[model samples]
Target chain A: MNTSVNIAGVCFKNPVTTASGTFGSGKEYSEFFDLGRLGAVTVKGVATTEWKGNNCPRIAETYGGMLNSVGLQNPGVDYFIKNDIPFLRKYDTKIIVNICGHTVSEYCEVTERLSDEDIDLFELNISCPNVSAGGITFGTDAKMAETVVSEVKKYAKKPLIVKLTPNVTDITEIARAVVSGGADAVSLINTLKGMKIDINTRKAFLANKFGGLSGPAVKPVALRMVYEVNKAVDVPIIGMGGISNTEDALEFIMAGATMISVGTANFANPYATVEIVDGIKEYMEKNNIKDLSEIRGIIE
Target chain B: MKKFIFAEVVEIKHMIEDIYDMYVYAPEIAKNAKPGQFAEIYTGLGEAILPRPISFCEIIKEKGLIRFCFRVVGKGTKHFSEMKKGDKLRLLGPLGNGFEIPDAPQKSIVIGGGIGIPPLLELCKHLKGEVHVFLGTREEPILVEDFEKTGAIVHVCTENGCTGYHGYAITLVDELNIPADMIYSCGPKIMLKIVSDWAKKKNIRAQVSMEERMACGIGVCCGCAIKIQKKGEDDWHSLKVCKDGPVFWNDEVIW
Candidate 1:
């Protein structure tokens, strides 16, 4: 009956939380479901300054999934501390702030700014595929990943969860690097870099030419990476990527993730997070499983 | 507490080639629905992950019906065309900030092109002032009859000269020398830019409903962002098309 998960010293009421960028500070989804029902609300990425994001055609539909190059458009960390934090505080859930930037200083600056704010955790987004500079660069390179994580760890007051990008030669190598640099936990895999071309227009469907593919299409790869990283690192893993239902979440938990974040699935079903929460409870009751730890990483 | 619900399709009529008019019995949406508001309809197409945002073409409150006229632009819309009467579609809406009609204008100009014309009809039906409707299309017009029923003075333009004016809707607006105290428009981005520019020149107050590739018809995704001048500020701000507005004041838009 105990679904609470502990990552580092932070205790989530339940193992269910929304993936960053997918849930916009919990204000938007708060209409569909109560924020109090969620274990944590992972907000959109915030940078040093407001970002304009990318050009038009930012989203496209593919088989069983979708692609987006939103470029982490946000209103900056100051705005989050002022507007979004107060709004989210009204809810009875933990708040995990996702921080994105073009440089290590930008990431550290956001962390330092939010250090005084009423937040629970920090999901350092070094894996955004849309932005050309600090995003994918810090994620894909083991050395840069280690340096950024270590530097941000210095300023981040809350537990740091380094979100890893899947576009790499060895996902586990980068996973090990972040944990070595003092990361409390790890979340993976941020969308896979992919492209879609409009047949009639004879051009890229997305304005950015390449976008991160999420949803059912990337589930297998995300699972493989989570499994690989779980074996490679000692830190707790938050498995995500195409988790649409309770079964998908259980698969991630059994594959060695302490918790799972629902990303693209929230688009398909607005009440997806709540549904997964209820479904997991039902699954545990039906299976006569008392603790989530019993099934955590049970899959060999 | 979920905004999404299943609405039973009461009727579906083929208005023109690849264009159809659909009415769904959704009392909840009808009760609070306004002009320029759109609904994200689940197209039942298994491959299509996101819902299609269709503007409310007509809101029949007494009967609890909402009409939408859509063109078969892609696979998602094509699936909407295939749905039969009595079918049910899951829709989330009355979403976004809709058009704000001023108290009593001297006259209102409602300009619309292609699929964008549908939402303007509901606007025309609500306005108390003198309404002037200008519709432009590629070849055939979709809702000419509906626009006429709104009692608005209608002007039609077809690019092939198959109907009224032989060019864009602005051509007729120019030749006829129509005067407007207020304006509302929705259409292709290029046409909106042109109309937005025209409104700026004449010092007329105008509102436009913008469109973009949207994932969550609600504001979360940040997928449908449009550049807008922050209120009382010269700097541009990224506004979500699904949340802050699909309808924005002309001056606010960074056209």
Candidate 2:
């Protein structure tokens, strides 16, 4: 009957939260459904300063998935503290701020600035592949990931969930690295690097030429990586990528995700997160399941 | 509030090669929808995840119907063109800001190129002034009768000289020497830029509806960001075409 999940002692009302970058601090989607229904609202990446992002044509639709090279366009942590925080505080949901930066200090600067804010968790985004510096640069390399997480951990007051990129060869190595560097929990996998070309134009479909692919297409790879990371590390996993319906969510849960984040599905269905939340409860009631733990990583 | 509903397809018509007109019965959307606003239509195909953002060509509030006139550009639109009447489509809409209508009667010029012509039809119908419509197409012009039905002065220009005036619609506007207090347009970026420039030269207020490759038709995904700067601003900011506007003041756009 219990649906609440605790990650690093911070309890989410349910095991459903939106993926960062997909849900913009729960502002637009808040118009569709009540924000309080979500376990947590993960805001977009906030840096020390505002980012202008890439260029037009930043997104392209592919087979069962989409590619985005938004480059973490944000209004900075100060803007979040001034505008987003107060707005989100009006809701009853937990706030998980996703922090992004170009360097180790930049990440710490944002974390230190937000350390005093009334938020629930800090999702350290060391896995954004769209940016040229400091994002996937730190996430793909185990040593860099450890260094960035440790550096940011010194400043972050709340539980730090290091988001991982799926572009790496061994995702578990990076998972172990972040965990070793004082990460309270970890979330994976971020978008996988992918590209599409316009056959008529003979040019890259996305303005950046390459973008991060997220959707149902990436779900299998994300699930495999989540399972592998779960086996390799003791930290709770927040699984994501291509999670649209409750069944897809349950697959991630059974694959060992402590909490699942809905990404690209939100675009396809604005009510995707809330629907999954309700669907999970309905599923549990129908199956006579007591708690999510009964199904969490049950496949193993 | 935007509603994601299963709208029953009322009618689908193949107006021309690659272009089709689809009408759906969704009272909630039809009641709330304004001209220039768009709907995110899901293909129902599992392979295509993102919905195709199609603008409302017409909103028949009396019958609780909304028409989407779109060309078969890609997989999603092609799928929509193949849909039959009575088929239910997953639609999320009344999204993005629509064109602003002035209160007082004034001279207005509405320009549209190719597929962009459909969105301007509703705006023309709702305008309270002298409406001058200039439609530009490659070979054949569609929606001439629809615009004509609105009682607006409709002018057609074809690129191939197959019909109407020869050359682009903007040139037709120049040749006709049509004077207006405001101008509105929707088309390819290059065409919009020309319209924006033409509006700037005349010192008239102008609004343009932009198009971009979009994932989410909502502002959540900063996918369809268009560079914009206010009149006095030094630097441009990335504004979501889905949320801030698929419609923006022509002068504010960093074209």
Candidate 3:
């Protein structure tokens, strides 16, 4: 009956938390349900400075998913510490801040600024594909990913969980690299890069011409990556990419995700996170499963 | 307050070739919904994950019903068109800041283009004083009768010259030269820009509803961002159209 998970000495009440950028500091979704219901609330990416993001037409719907090139628009760490941290402190859940930057120093600057904040963890985002620099650039390369993680680790007082991009040729190699460079835990897979064209206009659908694809369409690939990364790295895996319902949640857990994040599905169903949380408990009870650890990575 | 509800389809009507009117029985949404606000209508298909954001055409509070008049633009809208009475679909609604109604009745001019004409019908019903409505369409016009029923002077314009006015609706508004205390509009970005410019020239305060490609109809996704400059501010900031406003004052928009 135990659903709690411990990631690098930080225990989440449950294994359910919102994916960054999708929940927006849990303000909009807070209208649907209580923020305390979930184990943790992962806020949007916070950069060293305010990001204007890309132009309009940033969102485009694909077959079983959606594409977005928001470019990690944020109000910076100072704004987040001043505004978001106080708001999240009212909740019972743990606070996991997702940090985004354009350079190694920029990443460390945010980490250093937030070191004294009352947050629980730092989700270093090197996987955002929409940005022109510093995001997926460091994520796709092992040496760069290792260097960023090790550099930011020096400034981050809280346990750092590096988010990995799926655009890399070998996801496990990057996973091993981050762990080697002092990443306490790892989360994967960030959106897969894809594009869509408007047939009538004969132009790209998204303003950025390409966007990170996330939703049910990317579930199978994400599950495979999570399983592979689980085997390759010793750190706990926070699996994501296209998780909507309880069945999807259980699959990722079986595939070796210590915790799961609800992403694009939140747009389709605002109550997706809480539903999966409740659904997971209901599933464990119905099957007479005592603890989540019994089934964690049971697939292999 | 906004809510998520499974609204039952009470009625459906095909008004024109691609446009259709759907009335849903949702007492909470009907009671809370205001003109210019929209609802995220979820398509039950797994393939299409995002909901279609449809604005309120009418809020029938007495009957606890809300009407959504939309055209079949893509896969999601097409699914809504095919829905029959008694079918229920998930809807998250009363989203975004609606149009602001002045306390004192003032002379107002409301303009809409194509599918954007629907939300104006509800705005006209709520507005007071001298109201002039200019509706523009590519070919044939719909909802002219509905606007006329609201006792507003309805002017129809078509691009093909097959209707009331020969040219665009804004051109007809210019030709009429009607004096107005305020102007309101919703349509294509190009048309909205023109309306904003025209209102500025006349020194009349104006509010225009905007549309952009959206993912999460709520504020979280930051998908539908519009550049807006607040009063007394030198720089324009990216404001979410889904949360900050689908309706904004013409002067505030960075266009």
lDDT agreement with native, every candidate: 0.90, 0.92, 0.93
TM-score for candidate 1, residues paired by index: 0.98
Q: Which stretches of candidate 2 lie above 4 Å from their native place?
A: none
Docking band of candidate 1: medium
Candidate 2 per-residue C-alpha lDDT over A70-129 given as tens digits, one digit per residue, 9 for 90 to 100? 999998888899999999999989999999999999999999999988998999999998
Best by lDDT: 3
* Candidate 2 pairs with clashing backbones: A1-A290, A64-B47, A215-A242
lDDT of 2 by residue, B1-255 (tens): 556789999999999979999999999999989999998898878888788899999999999999999999888889999999999998888889999988888899999999999999999889987899999999999999999999899999999999999899999887787889999999998999999998899898789999987888888889999999988889999999998999999989998
- Which regions in candidate 3 have their CA more than 4 angstroms from the true location? none
Worst 10 residues of 1 chain A by lDDT: A25-34
Better of 1 and 3 by DockQ: 3
- Arrange candidates by TM-score, highest first: which order? 3, 1, 2
Tell me how each candidate scores on DockQ against the true complex: 0.75, 0.82, 0.80
Candidate 2's DockQ is 0.82
Measured over the true interface residues after superposition, the C-alpha RMSD of each candidate is 1.2, 1.0, 1.2
